[model samples]
Target: MGTHYEGDLRVALLDAAVLALGETGVDGLSLRGVARRIGVSHAAPAHHFGDKVGLLTAVAARGFELFTEHLAEALSGGEADPVAQLPLLTRAYSEFAENYPEHFDLMFRPASVRVEDPEYMRTSGIAFEALRAHLEECQRRGWRGEADSAALTSAAWALAHGIAVLRAHGSLARHYSDPTLDAVEDIAVSLLF
Candidate 1:
């Protein structure tokens, strides 16, 4: 029930912040708690991350990077049909949220971290580009949607992100008999395409 973090304290601190966020939510998260989780002195996190917002911002940045990586991998999978790619992308989005719920929570909650922070700006762009690129590909493939790529991508992200949030917080549990997220994502994306 605990991580035995080795090598880098910064990594340990990040992991600890994520773990704390998942267990306690944003209000309960603090630098001291993260230090306690990692068996470090209270000053350790303060020195490493400066403050609570700073620590959570770092977590958000990492979340965006991880999310983008998974999304890119899903896009690169052997699904050439643009319509077919929606399900893959949905599944990948849910997977990232499930695998890193703490980071996911921090990434979406603007108050926890500065939404305009440079790290967040860059990393979120990377994540958003995956969806935008897919929408462009769909357009090029002769999909007759009139909306621009930005609009399409925004809608796609909203649906995918909504599913991930629901699944992460168990909101989907009441509706779906199957706890596995893939079926839910497939069904949801099926409605869109």
Candidate 2:
């Protein structure tokens, strides 16, 4: 029997799942493990999330929501010029990845979560659209030269994602200081514009 969870069971399960993800990763995460983390019966997570994939999909969706917030904040906090905002957004992306490693891992691993899940699509789309909108603005102002905005957005995302992944895995820090990394990221973003 599941213990009575007085709070929002769905949110509780998601929180426990994130902790479980940090410990076990996608392959090792189980509904039973998440439930156990919260002192509930193993069936509790299944009841809330249908199955492991469903649970992971929820985690990914939540991750995207948070990721979008970070990007939006970065966009608002930076200069009005879209070209100038690229580095800020890029820094936010890396910071998000660094701060939320488990969510970051689950968000990008489509094989681990249902990419077709509507909430997943909506939240992830919002995050990407923020970047796309900024890139479009840059194109409109001719700040990015004649490069196709769509391609530029993709390149920008790739660069930021690459840096995040490299830093998360300790590859970037092994070779570069924080200032050096910032300089490298600035140079890379400069190349895009």
Candidate 3:
């Protein structure tokens, strides 16, 4: 098996941070604990991340990068059907949150990330722009009843983000249960259109 001790410690540390986030929330996340999880000395992560916030910012940045990629994929396949794309786009958002719970949590919580950081801002903007573009297309095609594309975009994002947050925290399970994440995702995606 590939070892966590090898290759890139920076990547390994971020992965460990995500795992730790599942065990404990943002306040409980620690650089030292991440290092120990990866079989490295506690001080090792400091070389790349200086501190916990720095590390989390990196993780959030990665999350946005992945989120943007998934969003782009939704827009691909030579389909001009904006309405049809909504489910794919939102599904991608939901999957990113569910798949990378730690990064997803930090991605939304400003306290854990340095929003002023250029890389973080740019990465997040990519994802935002992708969503905006789809909403614009929907508006242009009159697929949505309203001409206010911005509101449409915000509403769609709210639905996806709410589902992501609720699922990540297992809030949905506490109230009503969906047999699986996929089932919940399908229900959430259907809500978009």
> Positional deviation of 67 in candidate 2, in angstroms?
0.3
The candidate that achieves the highest TM-score relative to the unseen native structure = 2
Backbone clash tally (model 2): 0
Model 1, position 120: C-alpha lDDT score: 87
lDDT of 1 by residue, 86-166 (tens): 788888888888888788888888977988889888998888887788788878877646778898888888888888887
Instruction: Tell me the spans in candidate 3 whose CA falls farther than 4 Å from its real position.
Output: 1-6, 74-80, 170-193
Would you estimate the TM-scores of all the predictions? 0.87, 0.90, 0.79
The per-model lDDT (C-alpha) reads: 0.82, 0.84, 0.77
Candidate 2, 102-127: lDDT as tens digits = 99998999998899999999999998
User: Which candidate do you rate higher for TM-score, 1 or 3?
Assistant: 1
lDDT by residue for model 3 (110-177), tens? 97789998889999888787788878877777777665777877888898787767776778678766
The 10-residue segment with the lowest total lDDT in model 2:
179-188
The TM-score, computed over Cα atoms with residue i paired to residue i, of candidate 1 is 0.87
Model 3 clash pairs?
none
**Clash-forming residue pairs, model 2:** none
Question: Cα lDDT of model 3 overall?
Answer: 0.77
